[model samples]
Target: MVTVAPTYHVPVLLRQSVDGLNIQPNGTYVDVTFGGGGHSREILSRLGENGQLYSFDQDGDAERNMPPGDGRFTFVRSNFRYLTNWMRYYGVTAIDGLMADLGVSSHHFDDEARGFSFRFEAPLDMRMNSRAGMTAADVVNRYDEERLARIFYLYGEMKNSRRLAAAIVKGRADRPLTTVAHLTELVQPLIGRDRQKKDLAKVFQALRIEVNHEMDALEEMLQAAVRALRPGGRLVVLTYHSLEDRMVKNFMRSGNAEGKTQQDFFGNRLVPLKPVNNKVIIPDEEEQTANPRSRSAKLRIAQKLG
Candidate 1:
């Protein structure tokens, strides 16, 4: 097991995910989700003197974990949505590999002021990049009941999304919803006590997905990664939710999130890359016992075609 600060975050599938990269000692690589830098550090250890690494994290807090005086490492203080833009600006025409662990770091949820978890009474501010973007409060309080219902239904996969949205709409009529407690209180009665935690997690997941524009940005980033990778380069992604996992799986198979396939007259499937694992990889009993949060993680890897 890799040694990472327990409080910041514990990397899931740390070895498996990095091994999937097929790291080249002298090749250029990017770690787009440099949450706790555990994976980044492992990648760095594998690189030779001439190799280069670009780690991206929009959150200012993540930068504090960078290894000092590392000549080959470059930290990009921007969202991974603009992966190609930043790579081009740095004169990097192509990269050998890219790794993105899309899970929200443990640090974010544990920090009470961030409002990423219902376990806290903090304000509804779940922006991954706190320096910009609308807070979760903005979405819950301002969005119409229909739009909010769509978010919960589509993103959270909630069966009672319409009812949940109606409750929020009615509850916030007297006063604006402002905090985690307020939102959970409004909707908990709509869910059974047996599934309160699971149902509430879905609510927060949907709001966080909307507040961060995660799905849209993920699509953009995945496409950018395809364009940025050199032939034979690898794309390794660790997704924490089904919404994003479906997008990644589809893209790997078809080079697009829609999962459409193109073929020539001979019926040969034309795709940009080949999927590395036929079945999605998940945590084993040992890892799950070590880190319960990693239970939902699904890892998928692909390589850019020639």
Candidate 2:
């Protein structure tokens, strides 16, 4: 039997995100994506005896990282999409702050069999929760050509999505694409030599996103974050992609449809939340050098307005 190494997820934007939460000493908080429990540990440190921290992680392996039992801390093994519902189950009506660090964890990518990283020659299985849904192999082999193209174009943002999809379709005619190495070779010729690596990463990213329904889950969780926070509560989100960052930015700025600042005929202020920073915060050069994954991270924060 091939023994799988224990999964180790490295939390991104650790200090900046926890600091942005502006945690109140005795206030309640939630870490929507408690991958390696790094941010959760930080939040727990800031909380007082009366404060409580509820964390969520879909991957069961994350439970292994949980801190020793503390009356003030609770960890739920579930996706953050059901954040609001799960919080209610825990008897939490509202919280003082919330944090979501979206996207796959380093542990997920590192597990070769999980197939989240292009570096490993593993089976095309990218489900964050292994038991729940379809795998990358299923999508690559079964999804129709048009649907495949759309997935690449929308999620991966690949310029040659159509051609790539066609290539995949043709390549799989003899047999289904079953592994990262196989798919990589099949699609390599479709992308120019100079841009092959980047294009492949994007394609894999799109597949992972779709396999996990990440964008939809983020949208749901964002709405839940807004609704579950009490007045004066904080929403701190760290996004690695433009789509997630844009959603956070827009939701923080306008706080309503039409992206218009809420106002009456006289133009009086009435926004639901106020942006803590007009621009997104990024990792400094030193930090990026230490952790390359921090290079693409963007942090945005807002405070719920009364």
Candidate 3:
């Protein structure tokens, strides 16, 4: 097992994901989710002296973990949604590989003030960047009950999303739901004692997705990944939830998130990426035992076609 500091986020499928990139010693690479620089470090180790790496992270804390005096690595402090723009700005038109480890990091959960975990009684602020963007508190306190219900249903996959949204709306009418505890208390009656934690996690996931605009950002990033990768270059992604996994899988198969292939009038397929493996890659039992947080991780690797 690779050792990483608690403050630095532990990367899932570290070897498998990086290896999937099929790194060329002098090729250019991008690690779009440079949370703790674990994946970026692995990529750097494989690079030749002439190789270049561009790692993006909107969180300021992540930059602190970057290796100093590394002339080959450039850290971009912006959301991965602007990946193509930044790459172009840096005069990089095409890259050899790109990797994105989606979703919240372990550091976010460890920091109680972030409010990513319901186990803590902190302010309901779950912004990954934390420097900008709306907080979870803002979404819960201000969004219409219908909008909340839609997100809970679609993002969280909760069956009782409407009831949950109604409960929050009714509860917050008395006062603003400013903290994690406030939201938890309002939803407690609807949650059974046995599934309280799981149900609460679902609601929190929905709120975080909405607050961060994760789905939209992910879709934009995928489109950008296709444009930014060179022919035969790899796009490796590690997704934690079914929604994210579905998007990655569909895009890999059809070059679109809808999972449908498009053919031209000349009977030629227009897909950009071909799956490295038809089946999803998952963590082994040993890795899972070591890091339970990686249990839900699904890795998908695809290569850009010429």
RMSD per model, one decimal: 1.4, 4.1, 1.6
Clashing pairs in 3: none
Candidate 1 local accuracy as lDDT? 0.92
> Distance (Å) between predicted and true CA of 296, model 2?
0.5
lDDT per residue (tens digit) for residues 36-132 in model 3: 9899989999999999999999999898888778899999999999998899899998999999999888888888888999999999999988888
Candidate 3 weakest lDDT stretch, 10 residues = 1-10
**lDDT values of the candidates?**
0.92, 0.86, 0.92
- Lowest summed lDDT across 10 adjacent residues in model 2 is found at 1-10
Q: lDDT, candidate 3, residue 273? A: 97
Residue ranges of candidate 2 with Cα displaced over 4 Å = 1-7, 256-270
Candidate 1 lDDT over 5-89, as tens digits, reads: 4347888998899899999999999999998898998898889999999999999999888877889999999989999899999
Ranked by lDDT, the better of candidates 1 and 2 is 1
- Ranking by TM-score, best first? 1, 3, 2
Work out candidate 2's RMSD over C-alphas. Answer: 4.1
Off by over 4 Å in 3: 1-6
